[model samples]
Target: MVNHALQVSAALADMQIFALEGSRPFGEAVVRHLGLALSAHEERGFEDGEHKARPLTGVRGRDVFVIHSLYGDATHSGNDKLCRLLFFIGALKDAAAGRVTAVVPYLAYARKDRKTQPRDPVTTRYVAALFEAVGSDAVVTMDVHNLAAFQNAFRCPTENLEANKLFVAHFAPALQKEDVVVVSPDAGGIKRAESFRQRLSHAIGKPVGAAFAEKHRSLGVVSGEMLVGEVDGRIALIIDDLISSGGTIARTARACRQRGAKKVIAAATHGLFMADAETVLADAALDGIVVVDTVPPFRLHAGPLKDKLIVLDSTALFAEAMRRMHEGGSVTDLLAGR
Candidate 1:
């Protein structure tokens, strides 16, 4: 494996990187790839359930990156994490830091980017405003629910990293000889699946088929039965940005199996695994599931789904992006495999 830290220059010598209490492990993984140590930060809890976090070391006139994955879990709600992150960024700016960038692996409220119903709240835009209010210069995240909404919502510079290369690197060799079809769990994700399919086809030196399952989500209930494109006797690979409750992917897997798909696998960037994911994802039709280690599988237990789950490391990808951003290199070139 390549040591990503060796690729860094003195340009990052003065950079300040911090991982909050909930995100220390992932932050450590990112800094490990960059061959740097985590900067000191202090978090204190007050009476009546309030908390505060601030940099222990000086950050004056230094480029700072805060690693925080704002995903709700048993320990903390998404709201709590978001509040803390914003407060920390505000503190950094108040300390006269030159720039503060939020490196959020699993951005929360991204799915609520738009309104399907009347008078719906655009939480994604509100979240963007929070970051901007705290003097955030930029935001970096991976595989958000809607790329367009994510970019347009943030006034600050935003980098949306794709896990395509990583997934391709993992799946290509294994499926190189098999007849494969990439299926989007929903119509909205057709573009994402197709983008992944093209790269995967190139990686395996073969053409891959495309498909999408009809899905309509209403008030947390998923309903749809239409399956488009052919999957008969071909390895079916379902692609999506996330697996919340596992309903969409599980339903799509069943649809693929009903249409005579030889094998059904699902690859999503963030595995939120909310609600009854452990039960839903345990479906026999889903042969395997692949997800990056952006959000830990805290909601999952050791069982059938756990046995089929594979977590890919995303630190190297984030590390490279951070390095490039700090050095003013082209992140687009990196994603394009240039």
Candidate 2:
């Protein structure tokens, strides 16, 4: 028989939470929701653009969870943040942590799950390899670009949390009496839009409609002005995994309005808002945008788009996931809000 006493001891062992520099605020929110204190760590950058991070406290035999969103900011690129997170995970493993789970709220390079062009790099697989190389026992992220590709790329245990329920809950009241249609900005996000529509429909006890905009990209240019499905005189909720430059969402919103959509709103799990994203999304067709707090919307908050932005707190969701993972409890209930 398995050693019951050993299992109990392991279960009772205190878990430590560490947040990397770029994700400190977000991690702090999650820690607060979990009633835990943030662990101390030291990070220093050399004059040569080299940096290092080390946990101040001993992590030997402890269950360690590192919170870091591998998204770029003013000072660091996405690659830089990824490297720092990877190195920190490796460091914790070297320190003999019994287990290390990487909690990446916004997993960068996730969109590059596959190659569309010849000789294109499969960055998602490569990132998964890097995580495995650092000895991560499990990788946890939210609303990845491609679920199948993400699961297939990682050899270790991977958990992808969904934001569908959260979004549905947020929009339930507003859409309860209105005719709402969930729309995918592009054909590739049809699955995501469908999930959102299903959950929202169930929550509001009404049959939510679905629609999609066809988009084609060539050499960084986007085309395809056609929209599929019924959206005329209905509130359109354009859904996607993330919003970077805001071009796709804007294009879809415009198309929806042109198709007689009464109102156009965009909802995404991550709001990257990169490079004049505010300017791009300021079009009159887009009424507002809702996004989860996976990535801090510093730029958007400081700009004119603040009035049109709705940010939902994801700390509770992440806290619950971490609790279940640490206690060896089933997370199925948390997946699609079962």
The TM-score leader among the candidates is 1
All models: lDDT?
0.94, 0.91
Model 2: how far residue 119 lies from native, Å: 1.1
Per-model root-mean-square deviation over C-alphas: 2.2, 3.8
- On the 0 to 100 scale, the lDDT of residue 140 in model 1 is 97
Candidate 1 local lDDT, 68-115, one digit each (tens): 999988788989999999999999999999989999999999999999
Q: Report the C-alpha lDDT of model 2 over 139-197, residue by residue, as the tens digit.
A: 99999999999999999999999988788889998887999899998888999999888
In candidate 1, list every pair of residues with a backbone clash.
none
| Over 4 Å off, model 1 | 1-9
Model 2 residue 142 distance off true place after TM-score fit, in angstroms:
0.9
Q: How accurate is candidate 2 locally (lDDT)?
A: 0.91
